[model samples]
Target: MTKFADIKGFVFDLDGVITDTSILHGTAWHQLADSLGVTWTKELGDGLKGISRMDSLEMILKAGHKENDYTQAQKEELAAQKNTNYVAEVDKMTPANILPGMKAFLDDLRAKGYQLSLASASKNAPRVLGKLGLTDYFPKIVDPASLKHGKPDPEIYTKGAELLNLDPAQCIGLEDAAAGVQAINGAGETSLGIGDATELGAADMVFADTSAVTLANIAKHLD
Candidate 1:
């Protein structure tokens, strides 16, 4: 009964999938690390993808050998501050910030009556979508505050499918990170990775970037 053609919903990860907000996230984390005298590295920032804010902070603290240096309250404050820094940059985004081909892809999906949902770990997903003029595309965004687990756990993707009133088997999930691909796969959705095939081998399909993620190509594969 679960035909591949039954894919009627899409669960999207906001950051690299719809747009490139990694630099903004990096800037925010770097600013926080500097304020705490913690050395920041690109690798650390890269590892933060598809994870929750607090988890990212924990990784940063461990990297700087400062994991035990802060109380829970202090850590929460630091996370809030980093969000403040990130939001400052997010506020500058516009529809032009949407990745090439992504808007067209979303339009095609919508025109076909496919439902869309957001499964980003960022609490700022709605705001970022708004800035990118994509708020109307995804009426259902899994609230990060409502989740107990982050990507690689499947909870967010499952919740996204639930919000779309579809089974995970009836959805295709797009992601740009390994953890996100894993989450989609774990939720039983066909996973499309917007990155190198070697890096995202677990995905059901891989595209070099958003430009390559066309509905036609996906339909070709599904056929």
Candidate 2:
């Protein structure tokens, strides 16, 4: 574990990595698209992952060929409505909603004294964590509102390391989205992707799911 010795913290992305909120997010965006008379597609839904709410809205608008149709204030109103829809579902989350093996993995990380911080683009990260009874696991959560840039720009992960008082080199970033893995790599942290190997090939390591993200398994890849 010599190569892992310097690792002091873990920065996590909340959506697919921590739990599955894609349905909630998709439903919200789908409803908004329908209201605006825009057609929704699977490809459009996939593009929203690991991105900020505003960015997601813009993407949806572009997909509908209505990018210039809404004023800035109107766009904000639409985004807010989308959030309202997402939050209604998020409020229903419970500990049971925590992904399989994730609680055990978090417990292992904590027992080993590895600091944890969240770098989710979602503004509702705290509420989701609270609902899932996992708020205390992450002492620091980078507020998306404070960032000038989102995932794949490195700002969020860099700030997460900063909040832990650690250098990017001393942290491992866990994510399940391509943009998030890019953000981790861009931040100079060890990147671990928790999904399909082909989609996440850029990461330093890839796990099929949370069940395989054990500390021992992580040690093997750190070297």
**lDDT digits (tens) for residues 87-204 of candidate 1:** 9999999999999999999999999999999998877889999999999998999999899887799999999999999989999999998888999999999999998889899998
RMSD of each: 2.4, 2.5
Q: Considering every candidate listed, which one attains the maximal TM-score? A: 1
Give the CA lDDT, 0 to 100, for residue 54 in model 2: 92
Q: What is candidate 2's lDDT per residue for 92-192, written digit by digit as tens?
A: 98999988899999999999899999998877899999999999998799999899987789999999999999989999999998888999999999999
TM-score of each: 0.87, 0.87
Regions of model 1 farther than 4 Å from truth: 1-4, 58-72
Q: Which pairs in model 1 have colliding backbones? A: none
TM-score of 1: 0.87
